[model samples]
Target: MLENSNNTVLSEVDTFTNHYPRSSIKRITRYTTLEELHSLANKPLLSIGWLIICQDTAIKNSYLKFLEGLDQSNLVLFRITSEQKCSELLSALKADKVQYRIINNYKLKEEKVIDYVCKNLSITKVDAKYLCTRSGYYLPEVVKNVQTLKVLPKITKPIIRKYTEDRRSIAVYDLVNYLIGIGGKTTYEDCMQLVYEYRYGFEHLLKTTLAQITVYIKIYNLILDGELTLANCKIKKKDLQDKEISNLHDFRLYKIVESFDKISYDYLILLQLKLQQISPKFYSGVFDFVALLKINAKPGVEARVSTKINTKISSKVKEDLKTSEKRLDEFNRKRYTMTTDDCQKAFEYLKEQRDK
Candidate 1:
């Protein structure tokens, strides 16, 4: 009787399992849409889905109109504006269903907008990715923003290593000088390659080395800071002349001195040659210390050295040392035998002359 009852229970279980809905067991493919966005606003404590609309004026107007046509009881359109009047206008038009915000101009400047979105919105990465993919105008910037947000700091170490392993620091500095010499224009890929080639060819420096990576990071940071700019290859190549080319050496020396203070002049010169050996593109320019000095002259001797070393002035600071032997030529031609008093008087005269 126990076995019969067990069999009965098993049959009932099987019958129930057979009747279970197959559709319910199937995977549901969910997608985001305007309807789902509306439903998100209906909860007692609603969390709004922030849509960053970066479209042309006409498209923006059309979107505003579409939102106005909807049952916007739960939806609030947030319009970001630059002009104070535009914000007021937008607020007046969609008084009940929309909100207006004025974002600081600086906040929209390169990569800052991403920080803004991450800070202001309560959203998932998937949702952020989706919004970035759908937006037309600021899409790339937004994607970059999200990437910057999600990227782990430790991951940057590998890139730094690759930079150093490639001897890219030398290449990057060379490229910067080349760009400056050629009037600050070049294709992005060409500039990227200028550094990348160094990394690929040099095996002594590994991408894993901290020292090597640090150099690359320093070079890139200079570029980002507008201390260096990249230009198109065709333009730079066309602008290249013997005179402009010769100045490249002096410019490089100046940059090194600027970056690393009072480095042995011999070491600085040797590094220039080593860089040239590693990359022939470096040899295209000449070094003009005198010209550099004229361009970067300061008010006094101490100030001059201070400014040159500190400010990265591309010139020689020790011109007096260079021309020290010629100092006697500045004296008057007549020689007179003199006592200590005469010598003191002459010294005072000479001091005044030198000051002039």
Candidate 2:
């Protein structure tokens, strides 16, 4: 019964999140269930909201199977995109008392969205129309393209075509792992090829790569200190929200933790150090940082194979980690104690590390 069309589900979700600016809104896909909703309902003090966006047929089927269990008493608000499913739930077969909101009436038209972009960016109706058409009139896609366009000096039809061209087949996750030398080596050409293939801005890729590095560093430290073991490495949903852990699936989290068995800690730290060095320079020029990564960010196979010679390299990495820790600590300390120019430099360094 799950219906699909040119739904404005994403824009509605964006509006919901914007409405509850201070609420700890949890966004997920098929992970949501009646039990999970009840668990959240029990914690009213958290002031949490739930936004579940599912396009998968399997997930929709799974949801339909449990629709009878849902009642009006449930506190969660479902902004489902499917009109048929909503109608079915409201029918006599399910719960007629079930409350819901249909967003189809509020959906933005192509002309309206294009005009918004045109007025906001001070661009002509032609360029804005092109962007909206290329972006499929999706609000988030249009916003992302607008941000990318803002970085450039001038907008051109060719540039819009380049940025809006979608290559859904490319696995950017594998490219990211390769960039950090997880499964294989990476090159500047490979990096730029990914840009062209995926059509994701370099800033987006850089932030994604940095996020993976941060997660690996956190998980690696826990493993090294004997605080976490693969046998008992289960992470709860609440812990993810509490500790601000990346909202990754359990399978992906497990795979990331398991990767440490083959990848060396030293290699991860080396890649992290290189990212830290270029991060500050990113504000000056993104190409400059990319060039730096090309020159110094390549982790060699020798380091990758260190897991085989752990006894020897483990000690060296531990010693080097101590020194690296001191350097990082000093770098952080200087942010508060440093002069104006130094503070601005530190600000840019931290800004590059953040995913905005």
Query: How many residue pairs clash (N, CA or C atoms closer than 3 angstroms) in each of the candidate models, in the order given?
Result: 15, 0
Task: Give candidate 1 misplaced runs (Cα > 4 Å).
Answer: 1-54, 60-66, 74-161, 164-297, 300-356
Ten residues in sequence with the least summed lDDT for candidate 1: 1-10
- Predicted candidate 2 versus true structure: per-residue lDDT over 84-119, tens digit per residue: 344444453344344444455345667768766766
Q: Evaluated with lDDT, which candidate comes out highest?
A: 2
lDDT of 1 by residue, 1-356 (tens): 00111122122223323433432121111233445434433333322222222211223443445445544333232322223234334555666555544333312332333344445345444443334332321534444433553543332323322322221122343343332222134433333343334434333222212232233334333433445433322223223353322223333423432443322232223223333333223222111211121122212222212222334323432542343333222111111122345334534654453233
Model 1, 223: alpha-carbon shift in Å?
35
Candidate that scores best on TM-score: 2
Q: Which stretch of 10 consecutive residues in model 2 shows the poorest summed lDDT?
A: 1-10
Assess every candidate by TM-score.
0.20, 0.41
